[model samples]
Each structure stands twice: as C-alpha cells, then as structure tokens.
Target: MHSPTKRHALPKSNVPAVQPTPATTTDLTGFTPADSSLRGLVGGTPVLRVSQPFTSPDRGFWAKLEGFNPGGIKDRPGLHMVERARARGDLLPGAPIVESTSGTLGLGLALAGMVHGHPVTLVTDPGLEPSMTRLLTAYGATVDMVPAPHPTGGWQQARRDRVTELLARQPGAWCPDQYGNPDNVAAYTPLALELAAQLGHIDVLVCSVGTGGHSAGVSRVLRQLYPGMRLVGVDTVGSTIFGQPARTRLMRGLGSSIYPRNVAYEHFSEVHWIAPAESVWACRQLASSHYATGGWSVGAVALVAGWLARTLPRDTRIAAIFPDGPQRYLETVYNDEYCAEHGLLGVRPGPEPELIGRPDEKEVTRWTRCTEIADPLAPTVRTESIEGGRAR
Candidate 1:
C-alpha cells in the first residue's frame, strides 16, 4: 500500500450552504415526494433527535437515520460513483460494475446496477452473511465469494484480488474502488447539508470509519458551516486505519485492515477504537431501551456519541451518523447466544485509550491528541497488536 502522503485531497468549500428544507413526511394520502421516485427515496432519510437508553434528554444527540435508504449509507456513493462515471464516459452503457465489498457497499452497488441499466458483480468473502448474499442476489448483483483469505492481507485483500480477476475477464468493467474513490467522499454532501438544515448549528460530528466515506464527506462539508465543530472518528480495535496493527476483528462495516485512500485523517480531531463487546453492549442498549439500533459500527458510534452527549456541555448539539438499521445484525449482534458465546454481552470498552498525537502522525497509537498531524505510515511509527474481545 502506498503511504497516505502520496495522495492528499484538498478540501473544497464550494458545496451548497443552503438551509435545510423541512424534512418531508408522508400523510395518510401517501403521495409524498419520497414516494414519487425511488432515487429520491435513497436520500432524505430523517435525522431524529435521540434521548434515552444512554444519555439524558439534555445530553442527547441527533441520529441521521440512514437505514431509510433501501441499501444503507453506501447507497449514496454507489449511485454517485456510477452516475459520475457514466457522465464522464468512463462507464460505457451496459458496462459491468465490479468491486469488492463486505456487505453495505455490495447492496449499494447492486442498487446502482439496478438503476443504471448495468450488471454488477460484487466480490466478497466467506464472512458475508447468508442474509446479505441473498439480498445482493435479490437486487440482481452477481456475488463472487473469494474462497480464502490472502496469505498476508486477509479477506479484504483476497476480495480485492478476486475483483481484479473479474475486472480482467469482463470488458468495460468499472470498479468504483470505494476505498480510494473521491466520489465516495463527495457523495455525502447532501447528508451534511441535511444535518445543517435540521440542526441550524452543530457542535460535533461522530461517525464510524469504514472506507472513511461518510465521515470524510460529511465532516468536510459540515466543517465549512461550523468551522469549530469537532469531528470524532470511531473505529474497531484491529483496524489499521488509525495506525493499529492488523488483528482478527469481529465487527464489520467500520475499520479496516488496509489503510484506505479515502480516509481524511487530517479532518478528524480525535479517534476512538471500540471493542466488539463494547459495541455489542451498546447495540443491545439501543434496541431494548430506545427501540432504535443498528449493526456493529452503529453501536460503536452510538457508544461514543452517547459518551460525548453525556460529557459535553448541555448546550452542545451533537450528531451521530447511524449507518444503517439493525436488520443485518439480527443473527449476530442482536442474538443473545452469539453475544454470550463471544463473551460480548456484559463486556465494556477497554480502559480509557491513550491519546497520543495528531491522527496523521506516525507515533500515534492507542490514542493521543497531537499538535501536528503526520502520515499514518511514517517509518517512525510502531504498531502494537490490539487483541479482540476475549470470550467470557
């Protein structure tokens, strides 16, 4: 992987600064604009204020409900990337869209394929849920399972390798490498705009880091409006995205074994690495206490957001991005036996993580607030293995 230094995207402030129109709602007549078009329904998801289960009303935050989209948060990028490519003539009509994904992006690509009159082939791994596999096929995406992990890089790399093979075999195949694509970062502009209109002003933005699309895209736009707003990044313990060594990670949809090109490390003010058990606990708390919840990344982001809401001043208005709903996690995160089997039920986040240096710095590990941000892969940086949650 190339050092993050090789590619640095300058932040642009030219995106729309419009006030948010009131969120549309469907009346009993059921003729709302959202019902008028499937594409319109992809966005315009609600940003609901959350208070309970974790934080008091005064300390509560708002949640951007991305599950309202048919395919989850990645749907924004899936369509944007495909449309952008088509406009540039990069994606010829009927070209096959092939890319590697875990699940969310697979659904997004499948949706894109459906709307743009093209076939999509998603390369994933054995860890993909049967439910998601069926969902992708239902959306007309051909699923290719990479049979094994790569010798050095694990399932993610293996899946990428398979995508390469498929792309080579298929003519005019376009791979919207979400990890490296600028469009993925650009796709969340409307989301940030929506939050801006809804909140009027935001003090903080909390998001999980997957391909780093939503966080990077949303924060960049929000920062233009609320320059003082803090951007908090959430990640799984084993992810190298924040300079941690690659270890077996239980949670998906956030964090990465590979340092993705899309992560805007400099944009983040601070980052949190949450354990699977901690996320499991948070997820259950949301489900039981508030009847609002999501998968691993959702729980992890909520945990941090809840903490921020509780600790920040009462006047602080925080917004946490919930990637998708809990439907995908029912077999794992929401399952008591699975939680107990994995020793996740009663577990909590690890001891307060050490804050080290600026996110771009190489020496940063565990956690650290630094003055100057540096390359995450700097030679001076040494990565320590972060263990997964032990079975209780």
Candidate 2:
C-alpha cells in the first residue's frame, strides 16, 4: 500500500452557491460529459417529479434519487473524502484506508479504492444490512466485523474500537471519523447546488439528521443559495439527536447517540421528531403506494417531506435526500413480518393527520454529548433491544 501524507479537505463555507448545468451552444451526438468530475454524479441520477399536491403542501415536493449511484448517497462523501485526501498528498496511491460505516460509506470506499487502486478496510458491526455486507465484499474490499452485541455492548462502539485497533497496527491508518470529520459534510455541499438547478429554487429542504454530516453539509450550502430557505431536520422520537436519552428503534443511518461535530444544527429552520414506526410505515408507503423503493433513512426523510409537502407553499421546492437503495434491506425493512416483530408495527396505515408542522419547543432537543448510550467518539456502540425477545 502506498504511504501518503495525511491531508484534510478545506473548511466548508455556509455561503449559498448554485450548481449550474453545462451550458452548450451546440449539440454534438455521441458526446459524453466530462469525466474526472464529481459534479457529474450530481443530477444525472433519476429524480422523481411529484405530481400530487403534498398531502399537506410544501412550496414544491421532490426527492433526489441518490440510490441511482453505484452504491448510494453516502458515496458522494465517500468518494470525495478519499480523492481529496489523495489530491492533498494524504493518501498514497495504494494506501489501505480505514473507516467505520453502517454500510453506505463502505460502498463509497470500495468505489474509491477501485478507482484509485487503493485497498479499503471497513470496521463494521454485525448489526449492518445483510446485503450491505455482500455489496462491500463484492466490491473487493476486506470487511472486518467488530465485537458482537454484549450485555451492554453496541455496534458503533465496536466498529470504532476496530478502527482504533487498525490504526494501532497499521503504520498509516486514516480514519475519516465521520462524526467529527468536516469532509463528511463538505463532500455533500454539491448536492445542494444540484437541487437548486433541478428545482429552479428551493424554499424548503427536508432531510434526516444523523451525524449531521449530510444535513449540515448540504443545508449550509443550500441556505447560502436561498437565505430564506427553510431547512427541516428530521429526528426519530427516541433518538439522542436533540440531546436526549437514546431510544432503541429499527431505523438506521439517521439519529445518533452522540453529538457529531460535523452536523450543523444551526442550518435547520425546523426539526421533526418522527417515531421508528412512522419511519417503517413511511418506507412501506413509499414502496406500496408511491411506487418508489427506499430504505429506513429514506422512509424517515419521506415522512418529514410528506408532512412539509402538505403544509408549505405549493411552489416551494422541497427536496429530500434519499440515501441507500432498498435492495440492501430485503430481509429487514422490506419484510412485513420482520417489521411486525419489531416495534415498528405500531405506526398505523391511516392517512397522515395534519401535523402542527412546528416542533415541540418545550421539549429538550439540542445536540449534546451522550452518556445514555455508549461513547460516540469510541469506535463502537453495541446494540441490544430493550425488548430482548431476540438479539442481533
């Protein structure tokens, strides 16, 4: 493996910038867009044009189809992180890069490794998507499973510990540390620009806030483009996102046990606390009724986007970032029996009621350090259900 010097991406500016489409005065058949540019991946993927008025009403409602990527939305950050590091002379041509991911980042890393001729090692827990494991392996990267769930163990902590172990063993281990790594958010800035070009103008942006990487990174840029842009950050009801006790749930990729420095909550104009059941139901709703397939995070995001669609102005361009594709969740989220076994069954099938749209101001909702769950900074957070009926 090549031993490249450690390099960091530049700090992201909150200033708004719009992404401009390729302006061509003449058409040339058999001409392809320029290669070697990340922006090329931005809008070429499928974007659904919503016809129905948001059950409530946003300025306008649409979803960016990030699942079209070879992996998923996280790939945007995954590729950028590795490439930027290499450009800055941080990653040697064949250096073995290490990272902790739920699954999405691993996909992105694999792509990066193949393109740059590098080796990628992923530190993940057993709680990951079954298909995700296969996808990473198919991409030709090494998948190292962390400690199983213990009496008080967690997958997040376990993965982080593996990263620490790898760093201690490997001479030049570079952990993206998505939680604190600014590049995680910085890599997503282009998404905001793409949406601006796609929607013409955005009045409200709906997305789930986990490590705050996607929301913070994208919202900062979107808010800058449209100063009046209303950014809605969605969190699960039992999530520690707003600095509360961690709640066990089925949704993945959104909400965190600790306050990630990369997430910029200040960029959000509003926040919605959706329950796990709601997210599961939303995922089903998207697939069964809307004819669109999405995973847990996308479903959680759609729950908020659906609500915002019905409440905000009709012309307001509402774009929600849909992370991974549904192919990875066939045995879990896509399984009705699996969902019924989980607490996610509680979310009913009735029409979505008129939500106040305003968040609970009296509620304690601020990003803060987590003690209720394991240390987020630590390499892993072993997962266990309070219901203990079956363990992962």
Worst 10 residues of 2 by lDDT: 365-374
Q: Write the per-residue lDDT of candidate 2 for residues 1-392, one digit (tens) a residue.
A: 99999899989989888889898788688787686354355334566754333363223358888888878888888888887888888887777899888887788888888877888899887778777888799999889987664232256666777788897898776767888878888888777777778877877777877778888887888878887776667776556665445645456777765567776644555456666676677777677655766887887778667665765556656788887678888888877788788756666533443333123223332221111222334454332221121112
List the RMSD of every prediction in angstroms: 18.2, 18.2
State the TM-score for model 2: 0.77
Q: Write the per-residue lDDT of candidate 1 for residues 52-107, one digit (tens) a residue.
A: 86677556989898987887899999999999999999999999999999999988
Which candidate achieves the best lDDT against the true structure? 1
Q: How well does each candidate superpose onto the true structure, as a TM-score?
A: 0.83, 0.77
Q: Candidate 2's error at 145, in angstroms?
A: 1.5
For all candidates in order, the CA lDDT equals 0.81, 0.69
lDDT of 2: 0.69
